[model samples]
Target chain A: MTHQDRGAADGTPRLLRSGALQLETGGRLPEVSLAFRTWGRLNPDGSNAVLVLHALTGDAQVADGPEGAHGWWRGLVGPGRVIDTERYFVLAPAALGGCSGTTGPASAAPDGQAWGSRFPFITLRDMAALEARLLDLLGLASWHTVIGGSMGGARALEWAATQPERVRHCVVIASCAASTAEQIAWAQAQTAAIRLDPAFRGGDYYRHDDAPRVGLGIARRLAHLSYRAEPELESRFGRAPQGAETPLGSPDRQRRGRYAVESYLDHQAEKLVGRFDANAYLSLTEALMSHDVGRGRGGVDAALGQLDAVEFFVAAVDSDRLYLPGQSEALAAALPGKPGVEYIHSSMGHDGFLTQAEQLEPQLRARVFG
Target chain B: MTHQDRGAADGTPRLLRSGALQLETGGRLPEVSLAFRTWGRLNPDGSNAVLVLHALTGDAQVADGPEGAHGWWRGLVGPGRVIDTERYFVLAPAALGGCSGTTGPASAAPDGQAWGSRFPFITLRDMAALEARLLDLLGLASWHTVIGGSMGGARALEWAATQPERVRHCVVIASCAASTAEQIAWAQAQTAAIRLDPAFRGGDYYRHDDAPRVGLGIARRLAHLSYRAEPELESRFGRAPQGAETPLGSPDRQRRGRYAVESYLDHQAEKLVGRFDANAYLSLTEALMSHDVGRGRGGVDAALGQLDAVEFFVAAVDSDRLYLPGQSEALAAALPGKPGVEYIHSSMGHDGFLTQAEQLEPQLRARVFG
Candidate 1:
């Protein structure tokens, strides 16, 4: 009946507990626990293991469960699918600062209180290090492929850059070598949105009756818009009023009905706010903002040049406005072998990394898993 | 000094008080006032008077004053500039729901209290109608040209569509015939940010010592990002820390310094929040959300077809992400004569309409103001 036992009852993510962990910022977490889900058994050599990282706001659940419950990447990560879980031991760990049963701001501290505002700042490097620890605990020496998209892609690239020998193949999709100024600017707005909410209480709202749902909702709406293509939004909802609602002519602004697009954003906001923690969102967003594969090694070109031992597969969503395809091209061009950037033709923008991931099946199979 | 007398002594905007003004949404303000500034003397025939409209966050001051005060559009509206104030009488009216000298949410109602929550919803058409009333008061029958950028562009287009005979020339820059789904989505986030601030108090915070400055700041930050180009930001502030402040490695979130881009956004937010009213921001944003020249006039092409007598010159910023160049192309294609869309080349995104406007000088001279 306790928090740690709840997941075990149902076929949910299992926990990996570890001792004090040091962060890249010279801060340290007294204890760390990662919630992870695994599919297929690892081979005796452990070379058939695949590490699947998730993007911001994404959970450890990459593929469907035994009952066929839907997962975010179900299309490419199921039995006999592009990833073919039947042949590979695929593992997906909820991000370190995530709300999905991971050691995040909402998790308990040594004082038995929620970490909340006291949680230390962690970067993508720190996140990758923690995942490495999990891999060590799982008796896995190396990964056949470390693959992801968006923030996940950044993490996958980090895995290859930091521990080149551990990852034989690295697939990064719809991401860049580092967070661009525009990306940082957007993150600033989102984090500001959450912080401006009075209910947020400086990232310590776990004990409060109400969380910063409104602020979190606004952040999600903004993020969702960036995730999709403008043309797709226009084609799907262009100036259309929501069912039975008039978006214009209302004398009272409060009484005015919502536009179809506004309604769509509201739905997206509600879905995220209902399940995610505000502090976790801020933490994860800040971490993504700190993403820089070249931070200590050198510039992006110098850092990527050192990854000769790791085979690289870089892909970009053609319509992605958040992470421009040019970034992916630059990342590919900077790699040791100057790999050609793969294109995922989609009208879904950055989210195409997830929705149109199937488009990269042949490329992924030939260059990565195969 | 009283609010009405303050502007009179300083060569500031002059106010025109009027009786109940009917709005497009069927609402009526018992008393209405428009603050406007004029350059140059009106000819005896009143045929040389040009209407220059300001975009969101801009006011009646379109050109430098006698004291040499700077104006938002000073470059193109000065003595011998493109819009030449010396040759043609130029008039700029503060928008109806603005926080400038014009009557708005912070303005006193007939009952001697701030309108605040009681302020009725107004659209671009309604705003144009008020300017029309201002023209009627000035004894001008028509405009030599009606020109503007961004929201002003929308208003100018509305003028040509609703009262084509009144506008001899219509120049719309970086604007579309209607607010796209993506634009609405962005607007929804901004309004939501303001509304989420507890200090907002259901839009009735005018009398409070503290206004919704935080909410307004967040809104401005989001807006400022959308107004500029991505590459411009990347090239200007690529992961640079602000001054001596470190963007990473601070254990406390509050103590952490900002990324250079974050500092830039903070400055933008602070500048706007200090001078603008949160309610006015929301009002104008929602009004923009209702921008559609074809609302009740069949459709875009049909509405534009009715404006055959009004010469059109449309322009778009090549790097504009908010209002894409394609939207301007579509707008130009829908016009009666199908004027080719002029491109304003700049690295400054949608703001290029203001910054790179000089690029269209020859075209504007030969096709529009000429």
Candidate 2:
């Protein structure tokens, strides 16, 4: 229920306090800890190890979400699945700014208080760097395949660009080499939505009586809409009123209930409200906004040009509006071998990368496991 | 300053309150009134009068902002511009659920109090019907040309189908015969944003000191982003910082400033908050959500098929993501002429229909005025 509870290293999520770490934004952290979960065992040679990264708001629970827990990418990772936990060692770590078992704004600083507004802005490269340390701690010299989608894909691409030798294969899905200005604009609106809430109280609302639930709900609603394609929403809900509730409210009262799509979005908002942290959402979105694989490497092409050693597979959801297929095509065009983008056709938009892995399984298997 | 100031019949902005109006949802409005402005002079037979419709958040201001007031289509509606106010008598009405000089949620009812939450949910057809009443008041028999973009485009299409005899030449830009499911979903998100704002007060926040500006701002931000194309933003801002103010804020504080694109959206939001009412925003947004020209006319084909009496020119922004060009094509195909979609090539996306009149000038003149 509190930031400390998640940062306390509950045994279900093992924690490691990584020594001193310097961030990409020129800020230094005296101590950093990451919460992670591993599936399958690492072979003696470490060649069988595979690192699977989670997207924004996703956690280390890649597959095995027993009980009532929800896993982000359950379709692709598990026993006998495309990821095949039985054959390959899979390690999933909560991203640096993630609230679920990760060292985020909610985590305690060296002074033993929640970082709150003091947590420095981190980037995807910083996440990639910290993840490298986590890999070293596990005695894995190099990852056989570093796979992820969306923000996770940013990290995977960052690793492949800055340190390809450490990754034998890279799979980037539903992501571009850099966050577009439009993407930043959307991220900024979401962050502004959270910050403008009176309940948010400057990202220091950890112990406040009322958190930014309303604001966060609005943020989630906006995000959920963007995550799916318009065609999907049209086909799914159209103009149907929710249940028998009329969309009409009196001149003296508020409008009642909603259209089915509104209810669906509200459901999405509530689900995130119970589990996700607003500050963490803000932090990760900033990190995503800062995502540029070519920031210091001249340009995207030159940056990807340095990843010749990493076998790469670029994939995109054909219906994706958030991360359009053109982005994946652009990424593939800049990659070492100029590989064609593998398209996963679905009505789900950008979410197809996480939900429709059946279409992606063969391509991933051919590139990474074949 | 007050709704009545705009609602009261002054010479510049003409206002009329019709009695006993029934809404699309079967609700009854004891009185319905609209604010409107007209340019040029109507001919003896009213054949030279053109009806111009405004999009969501737009009022009767189609052109001629003498001061520095921001006219939505100022560039395209001047003495000798595309719309040519000098020659054609152009009449624009503030939509029924509008705030600008219109009888909307902010307007006082028969009880002499702000309608606020009590305002009825009106539809695009209802708006067209009301506008028809306004035309009757002005003693205009029929319009020579009917043109609009976006939601105005929706109104134009509705006018063409539901009352083809009233419209001689119809030019629908960046809209379709029906509100697509995707459009509804986006609208739902905007309405939810207003509702979630604690300050919104269930649409009755007119007299409150705080009036859901944050939520409205968020809604505007979401809408403005969609109004523009992603590639345009990427080309213009491209992850650039706003001046030298960084995106990084301390762990104990909120993010300081914004990226260039973020600042742009913020500016757009602030502008709307200053001049627009949130409840009216919600009302007009609902009107847009219910904009299905096909409703009661069977399907889209049947509805568009009924518009044989009116000559139609369907135009779409080549880069529009919100109202795709395909929707325009479908609308044109359903019409008796089967007109090919007129493409306005620009990076402006949906806004292209408003901003890129230079590119569309010759085509529009040839199709609608020829």
In terms of docking quality, how is candidate 1 classified? medium
Per-candidate TM equals 0.96, 0.90
lDDT of 2 by residue, A179-288 (tens): 98888888877887787777888778877788888788878877887898877787788777789876543332355557787788879999999999998998898888
Instruction: For candidate 1, list the clashing residue pairs, or say none.
Output: none
What is the fraction of true interface contacts found in candidate 2?
0.56
Of the candidates shown, which would achieve the greatest DockQ relative to the real structure?
1
- Model 1, residue A362: C-alpha shift (Å): 0.9
lDDT (Cα, tens digit) per residue for candidate 2, span B214-240: 888888988988899888888888878
Residues B1-370 of candidate 1: C-alpha lDDT, one tens digit per residue: 1324322322256788867778888888888888888777666687877888889888888888767678788767867788887677788899999988777889998889899998999899888888898568657778999999999999999999878889999999999999999999999999999989989999999788889888899999888998998988999999999999988858776677899999999999999998899999988999999999999899888898778899999999999988999999999999988998999998999998887788898899899767
Best by TM-score: 1
Where in model 1 is the C-alpha error above 4 Å?
A: A1-12, B1-12
RMSD of 2: 5.0
